[model samples]
Target: MRIFLFSILLLLAGCSQTLHINERYSASGQNSRVQYIVLHYTSADLNRSLQLLTETEVSSHYLIGDRTPTIYRLVDENRRAWHAGDSQWQGRTWLNGTTIGIELVNQGFYDTPTGRYWQPFAPAQIEALIGLLKDIMQRHQLPPGSILAHSDIAPQRKVDPGPLFPWKQLADAGLVPWPDADAVARQQALFSASLPTVQWFQAQLMRQGYAVPLHGELDQATRNVLAAFQMKYRPARYDGEPDAQTA
Candidate 1:
């Protein structure tokens, strides 16, 4: 009788432990409102990136390797990952709540003449990124312009997934808008003779979903927003100044 009681107690304890483990693994408490997919470059090699993302608290939903176009899923899509730190978009802060971060392996930026550094993104990696992005966008019902870079949300401090990223290629696939060349050309003509009012340009940028101050002054905040915009829409020249074409 004593042995039987002991065995029953052990069985109940084991069952309780199993139930707790199963509850922990279940998705009862996970976030479900994933809306945006943010892209980033690891600025490190594949192995290092994998190790850091897996071991460290910082993580992303997916990591795309440089050599091959394959994507490694690090975090589940339904759960929130620890990425997009100190970010803001369209007046919303802390983008991690609504975004899925995808980190690609790359060296990021390199110095060049004119004291400007350029970053190189591999063509194959970008191609792979497009497919992954398409699937995520479809799953989340993300809009055409919903796809964003790490730098786009954190322009004040971060610059990863830098200027070399192929926004045009993504736009070609109907992922984002390709600024109307004709509209830009017309704006360029108007801007050449005289710079448009700072307020006018700011309004256009705001209309395009950039967070610009409405003060009508081309200040640092405005410049940062313009630089981010130019990097995405007009990659050829991201001088940050409201030049003829940018204006």
Candidate 2:
């Protein structure tokens, strides 16, 4: 009886060890604590973009192709991808730690010799993005404003998902906060009046969750933040100057 009991104990211990090993492997291979969903443009074709994201050091959680409204999950939602680098938003830096990045295939911001520019994103691609974003937002309980662009967070160094991105369409779909046009028009009187000091503009940008130094000077960082805001809101001109309309 004693010999039989010893053998049974050894077998139970081995099973427990195996179970612990399996659990460890599973946890190490997957992602966790996914919070924000960030949008980006690959600036490359679909095949090349996928190859680069999967094989190269750069990767995203999801990739949307042109002409098709399907999303390719490159990295699992639980694992961290190396997409966002040197980013900041709402006074917080290093967005990769808290965001899931989505890369859309496109060649953004091509300039012509005649000073005209071209930026094209297919309708199917936008549709795919909407669906994917809806799923991610629901799963993670992310707020509508948390759905951000790479350029929105890192304006100085990145411009993916550029001005051509139809942010208004997303807003119309109840995916994000569209600035109240009436409020903007009413504020236009204040903006068009006396040229507000750089301090005032900096405060506004800070209140809007953009990273800017409160030095009261219109520095490059301030210009970048203003340009990002105008790209999303004004859209007509994003020259970074606090003109009568943007002041």
Candidate 3:
């Protein structure tokens, strides 16, 4: 009877998960919890950024200011930050769990009577960002080019970290990949003569880690995805249309 009662107590303790785990054994197949780092623009100044991120349900792991380029850690890295909303990448959805989000203080864009104007990231801010990214990537042991723009994860609904976000800077810093200019020029000449089909474009974007459709139609959704890609690669023009440059 005493043995059975003791067994019952042990079973209850196991069920409760109340015992301290042993640290002697380690698994070789486990990866870091952080697989990607997402960049975003707060679309507000420092004061408003704090208010918005703190007052609302929206939050990020880090927030960088523009003027002095101050770095703020609003959310701990061990915890999930509510930054990537309705986002997906590499077939993984709801990236708040496996990603770290960093928000930059910028107004994003403004639509005037002439056209839309995007805000450029400050130089000091970019420098600070590079340092911060290095620290995070070092700590997490993340691979190069694991950084993603918010639009890359959710092209349909979000466009922050827009055209002026300077992806090439990240690429130059060895944080992201940049296309070969010569290769792009040659491809441009060929595409300018004869643009590829919608199916081909869809396949290429999908190859570039975009969740574009393969239905062989130029739908609005597909255009949005293309626009997101263009915004990062070719910032001069991103009308979401399949043209020679886009091709």
Candidate 4:
């Protein structure tokens, strides 16, 4: 009986060493793991999109269909998705670990005489997306600025949810930020006479959450990042030129 009691005490002592018991509770500061919601275009049809997002390596938290107004919840919000690959945003890198990616089923774009023509998202599809965004943001306590484009995070390699996307509509709905027309106009006028230097443009791009190279030269990488920004804001034309409108 004494041996049994001694063995039990030894086991209890070993367990205590590995366990921590704290009963104090405070409801003060709190935050969620989710920080950003990145949007993308599947660039494939609905069936193909479902296949790629499911059977293949690529995945997303949600996918809005092109034809049907169905919002497929491919991955749970609490889990990570393999959507944003090698991405960075506002000094944060490898966004796949920290962001919720939503893929929209659209054909992306094709070049034409007028310009690069990107397929417009269906109204119902966008409505569904807005609803999903509202729910996710509300649950995660995410701000409007957290809503971002996949292109915005991976400028060097991506430009999906492309220029034809109705960013203003989302902005109006308070889902994301949009530049004030008056402010943009004033800046355009100021920069029209002489566009800002490459360094200045790079600085502004960084301020807008793009990871641009501050080489003071308009290199290809810088141009790609600028084009991604223009594609989101001033989609009318994005020749990667640092012009008044682009600024």
Candidate 5:
């Protein structure tokens, strides 16, 4: 009986071993594991949104509901969430490893006889989102311009958090960057005089952190990416064709 008890104790100890490590120093040359925040709109109500994000194969770090504008932390920030599937940003692919995703409950868009109609976000929802964004940015020590729309990172397939998302409000809140009207007007004048070549547009888009092709052709994929940028910066029109304004 003594020997059996000793063996059981040994097994228990093996199962519950702990490790101790030194914490005398910190590194100054390293940056944060999280580099970007991707925003999305869940095309469902609160209950369906909860079901999709929590009980399915998809998930995000946070979800903002529209009815009460409640913020839900579906997943912890210390762990990876499956929100950004097959996503890329600024030359970094597979953004799920390095991005925090926030989904807002919305109906997204629908088509009518005239054209497509997008659902506008409520003031309360936007307010709640701004508060949540500030908290996340502060806690993660993220810099300005670290937020991106789902289409911005995955333009080829996704377009949630669409054009009516009030990006200017975010810029005003210092959460993202806004273009200088003077600089854009100057460039627009130059482009008006002589528009840039397709290759030039491709190069510029690549520099803007999109994964565009450099083949100098106005292909569909390139146009899709351009449309993504246009929707964010110039919501008046975004037909995916290069224009003086787009330039």
Candidate 6:
């Protein structure tokens, strides 16, 4: 009887040790570390997108397919994804640490005799993305403003989720805020008389969450940022020129 009891005690102790190693106590009122949702275009079809995002160094948390569309979660939300390379937003830099990336299977753009023409995302794909966005936002308690475009964060080197992206649809779904048309029209008129100086444009761009140089010069860097902004807000024309409409 004594030897049997000793074996039982040893088994219980081992079980307790395993439990201690596997389980942890936690406090309440804590949330996920996810702070932002960055959208991108895969620039490839379903098979190619899966191949690149899954097997390559670049990856996103989710990928929305095109035809026969569905949202494929490539990376777990708790883990950091390799998207958003050399990126920034507001005052934060290196956004991959804090953002969840969602890539849509898209052709991105094709050059034409007129200009570069960007392809539009499929309606079904966008719908799937909206549902995924809602789930992520609800779980993370993120606001509409936290949803961003890849181009918005990395203006100089990246332009995925380009002009044809349906930002207005997200805005309509209350997932993102859109610039007031009335206000833009008023500002456009005001600036038309005399376009703001390059310094003012830089300041406004910075205020609007773009990381542009404040050197008061329309250099290549400044043009790149302006083009990025126009790609999001004024997609009809993003010539990188500081005109009244873009101002």
What local distance difference test score does each model get? Answer: 0.84, 0.82, 0.93, 0.90, 0.92, 0.90
With candidate 2 superimposed using the best TM-score fit, by how many Å does residue 143's alpha carbon deviate from the native? 1.4
lDDT of 5 by residue, 1-247 (tens): 9999999999999989987788999988986788999999999999999999999989999999997998999998878999888877789999998999999999999999999999999989999999999988998899998999999889999988988899999999899899999999999999999999999998998888888999999999999999999999998898899999999
Q: How do the residues 34-133 of candidate 4 rate in per-residue lDDT, one tens digit apiece?
A: 9999999998999999999999889999999978979899998889999999999899999888999999999998899996677999999999999999
- The positional error of residue 113 in candidate 1, measured at the CA in angstroms, is 7.3
In terms of lDDT, the poorest run of 10 residues in model 2 is: 18-27
How does candidate 5 score on lDDT?
0.92
> Top model by TM-score, which number?
5
lDDT measured at residue 25 in model 2 versus the true structure, 0 to 100: 38
The predicted structure with the larger TM-score, 3 or 5, is 5
* lDDT of candidate 6 over 116-140, digit per residue (tens): 8788888998889899999999999
RMSD of 4: 4.2
1-247 per-residue lDDT for model 3 (tens digits): 9999999999998899856889999999987899999999999999999999988999999999999899999999999999999988888899999999999999999999998988889999999999999999999999887999999999999998999998898899988888899888898999999999999999988877788899999999999999999999998888888987777
Error of 5 at 81 (Å): 0.9
State candidate 4's TM-score: 0.87
How do the predictions measure up, each by TM-score?
Answer: 0.82, 0.85, 0.90, 0.87, 0.93, 0.88
Candidate 3's TM-score reads 0.90
Q: Which ten residues in a row have the lowest lDDT in candidate 6?
A: 18-27
Task: Specify the highest-lDDT model's number.
Answer: 3
Q: Write the per-residue lDDT of candidate 2 for residues 78-169, one digit (tens) a residue.
A: 77899999988887788887889999888776768887564678998898788888888888877788888787888888766777889999
User: Per-residue alpha-carbon lDDT of model 1 for 102-131, expressed as tens digits?
Assistant: 999997876677676665778999999999
Error of 6 at 238 (Å): 0.9
Flag regions of model 6 displaced more than 4 Å: 1-16, 19-29
